[model samples]
Target: MVIGAGPVGENVVDRVRAGGLTAAIVESELIGGECSYWACMPSKALLRPAIARSDARKVAGLRESVYGPLDAMEVFAHRDKVVGHWKDGGQVDWLDSIDVRVFRGHGRLHGPRKVEVTSPEGERHVLTARHAVAVCTGTRALLPELPGLPAAHPWTSREATSSDRVPERLVVVGGGVVGVEMATAYQALGAKVTLLVRGGGLLPRMEPFLGEHVAAALTARGADVRTDTAVSAVVRDGGTGPVTVLLEGGDHVEGDEVLFATGRKPRTEDIGLETVGLAPGSWLDVDDSLRVTGSDWLYAVGDVNHRALMTHQGKYQARIAGAAIAARAQGGDSALDTGRWGAHAATADHAAVTQVVFSDPEAAAVGLTLAEAERAGYRVRAVDLDMRSVAGAGLYAQGYRGHARMVVDLDREVVLGAAFVGPGIGELLHSATVAVTGEVPIARLWHAVPAYPTLSEAWLRLLEAYRG
Candidate 1:
């Protein structure tokens, strides 16, 4: 049984059914989950046009023709098409084809191996799992505690991604991926954007240079990027007027809409975790196989596990957990392989988590940064390259301003991480993910020659920098 029929839980059910196990999934909201409807799909749809136009303006002859603003209505229409107009009928059909039972309502742990689902109509149904119960309920946007924030009708990630009309002025309050991405999209779609970052810079989780490049680009695009700024309070009169965000220093910024993209918290509060002797609102602790710690039949995958909050990583964990459950159901411990990088182990969660921030100068990275590797006690060296130095990058864009870094573990002579900050680098992340997760030796990487005159040739430049 799976609770939360998001993409994570859907993948779990798919895998379990593939292993000849019956599955039932319960969801209180949409069937396809946050990524399918709100976070990834709609957000990227909104960004693609903006990024495409930005890239076009960088080209030699095309720059003059593409300087016009994007058609905001068309962009919103495209986004709506991408998200299937916020409907899940097709997703429901897919689940039906897979033969997985779908329960629509709030699902919670009734007891061990039992789930009690409360339907929207207030009907109660208790489901007992014969094999395992997997919880894939993802996280929700975290809004900071600020005065008048709740009453001001502040937009969370959900609202930011789903809103049809762009605001005349947008005050984004975070430096994280959601904040930066939304700011980029709205600014391009014709909004005066003020990005208020409490931190010193943006994309603080990645290498410092990545954030620096992004900040510079956003500023160049006319975004008011403020660093080391704190919001003391937010006030919106009548809940529909311009929002005034009061800063810590007695300064204030007003916007037609204020979006709080601060952070995320697990969506496990009312999921009946207390019945299982676990904290009601805490992230679930999981083993390598994604089984909840201290419980054999209970599993937690996706954002709720707090392993990696990415949708792709959650789906990866779902696959591992599903396989592990199948293996154990057939036999005992003998049938399972829980060793490092084993079929049933989510080893990449720790070593090779990858992400691509779809902001105007796209930031893509896999595995660790140089700081992360050093903190992990690995003897690592970071090799940096100006992406414009690569012949392919110069051909791709006029100025072609970007940076790439490869962190190599000196002891193992393998690539520990790679970060690329520039346009058209999102697709380049998979190669780095392969190198880090496969533990490909630096010597072996030298032989994997990159194709000439493409952005991918940045790989060769990165290798040369490492050699130097």
Candidate 2:
């Protein structure tokens, strides 16, 4: 049985059924999960037009043609289309086609291998899993506890991404992916946007230079990117009026809407973890195969396990967990393969976690950064390059300004990590992901050459910088 029928849960059930196991999946909300309606799909849909226009304006011939604000209605319509009109009928059909039983309700654990589902109509159903139960419930937006903040009814990622009408003026709190992307989208759609970052800079998890580059670009595009700022209080008339965000320094920012895109916490609080000897709100601890520690029949995949929060990473965990569950079910303990990169192991979570932040001058990275590599006790050489030096980048954009960095593990002679910040680096990340995951040697990488007059040539330049 798989609880929380998001993409991760759906993938888990798919793998389990492929391994010849009967499975049932349960979801309380939309079957396709957050990514479908409120996250990856809708968010990307809203950002793509602005991104495309930016890309076009960078090109010489197209620069003269592209100008002005994006059609807000058109963008919202496209986002609606991308989210399938916020409906799950198609997802349901696909799940049904796969022969997985679909249960619509809130699913909670009723002790070992037992699930109790409460339907919307006040009906209840109990399910027993003979083999294993996988928890694939993801996370929710975490709002900071400020006095009267809840009363102000601020937008989280959900409201920010799925909102049909752009706020006239948006004050976005937090400088992470959600905050930056929503700020960028609304700014492009004609909203006066002010991004408040409590930390030193934006995209703080990536290389510092990446954050600097993104911050500069956002500023160039007319966003008030304020760093080292925090909100201390909030005021709204009746939870639906203009929001006044009081800053830490006694000043306040008033806007038509205020968004707290702070971060996310696991959605495990109400999922019945306490019934099975686990804390209700705590993150679930799991082994490499995604099995809950000390429990053979219970598994936790996706954000609920706190392994990795990204959608793609969660789906990868689901595949591994599903395979492990099937093996343990069919052939018992002896059939399990728990070695690193084994059939059932989730090795990439530890070594090659990849992230792409879809903001202007997009930020992308795979594996560990220079600090991470050094802290891991690896002898490392970090190489940096101005991405503008790449011939392809110049051709792609006349005055292309960006940076790329590669962290090499000297002892292993392999790339430990890579980061790219530029107009079109989102597509460049997977190559780094492959290099890190495959542990591709630097010598071998020299021969797998990137074609000229493309952003990919940045890889060749990094290699050259490393050799120098």
Candidate 3:
């Protein structure tokens, strides 16, 4: 049995069924999950047009033709099309094609390898997994507690991404991926955006230079990016008026709508964790095979485990967990391949997690940053370069501005991490992920040449600097 029929859950069911086992998936909401509707799919749908127009605006001859604002209606229509008009019929059909049983309800653990699903009409179904049960319930936005904030009708990630119309003025309350990406999308779609970051900068989890370049680009695009700002209170008259946000310094700001993208908390609460010797609302601990600690028949994948709070990472873990379940079911625990890079181990989550932020002058990173590598007790050297120095980058965009950094392990002379901040950098991330995951040495990287007059040429420049 698998709970939470998101991409991770669906993948888990797919893999286990491929192993010749019967499987069932339970979901209370849409079958395709958050990424299919509200989060990744719709959010990226809204941002892509803005990014394309911005890319065109950078080229000399094309800049004049692409100066107008994005067509909000057409953009929203395209977004609706991409998200299947907020329906899950196609997803359900796909699951049916795969021969996986779908249970429509809220599913929770009842004990070892037992699942209880309650339908919307108060009907309950009990399911017993022959081998293992997997939890793929992801997370919801974490909203901070401020006076009257709950009554103010603030938009979390769900509403921010799925809204039908863009607000005239939007006040964003965090500087993380969701906040910045939504701000960029709405501002390009014609919202006057004011970004509030309680921290000193944006994307604090990434290398400092990546955030610095992103902040500069956001400002250049006319977003009011404020750092070290906080909201203490909120007021919305009758829950249908402009939101009035009271700041800590006794100042106030009002906007047509306010978005709180502070953070995320796992959706473990009310999932019956207490029935299984585990605390309610706590992140599940798991091994490399994704088996929940202290239990062989239980596994947790995705954000519910708190391993890596990303859609792609969760899918990767699901594949590993599903394979492990099949192996253990057929040939006992001893047959499981739990070694690093093994068929059933999620080794890349620790040293090769890759991410790409779709903000203008996109930010992409893979593996450990220089600071993380040093803290992990590795001798490392970081080589930094102005991305504009690459001839291909200049040709890609007139007056291009960007930065790239590669952290090399001095002891082994291999790339530990690489961060790229510039236009067209998203696609360059996989090369770094491959290098970090494969442990490819710096000398071997030299033989794998990057095409000339492309953003990929930045790799050659970094290698030359490392040699120097």
lDDT of 1 by residue, 1-468 (tens): 999999999999999999989999999998999999989999999999999998998899999999888999999999999999989999999999999999999999999999999999999999999999999999998888889999999999999999989899999999999999999999999999999999689999999999999999999989999999999999988898899999998999999999999999999999999998999999999999999999989999999988888999999999999998888889865898888789999999989999999998999999998989999999989999899888888787888899999999999899989999999989899999999989999889999988888888888888887888
Clashes of 3: 0
lDDT of 3 by residue, 1-468 (tens): 999999999999999988878889999999989889989999999999999999999898899999998999999999999999989999999889889999999999998789999999999988999999998888989999899998998999999888988898899999999998998899999998989999689988889888888889889889989989989999998898788889999988889999999999888897778889999888899999999999989899998888778899999999999889888889988898788889999998898888899999899999998889999999999999899889999898998889999999999998999999999999999998999999999999999899898999899999999898
TM-score of each: 0.99, 0.99, 0.99
For model 2, residues 1-468, the per-residue Cα lDDT tens digits are: 999999999999999999999999999999999989999999999999988999999887788888877889999998999999989999999999999999999999999999999999989988999999999889999999899998988999999998989888999999888988898889989999999999789988889999899889889988888999988999998888788989998988889999998889988888889889999988899999999999999999999988888999999999999999999988987899888789999999999999999988899999999999889999999999899899988888878898999999998899989999999899999999999999999999999889877889888899988888
Q: What is the Cα-based lDDT of residue 354 in candidate 1?
A: 93
lDDT of each: 0.93, 0.91, 0.91
Candidate 3's C-alpha runs over 4 A off are none
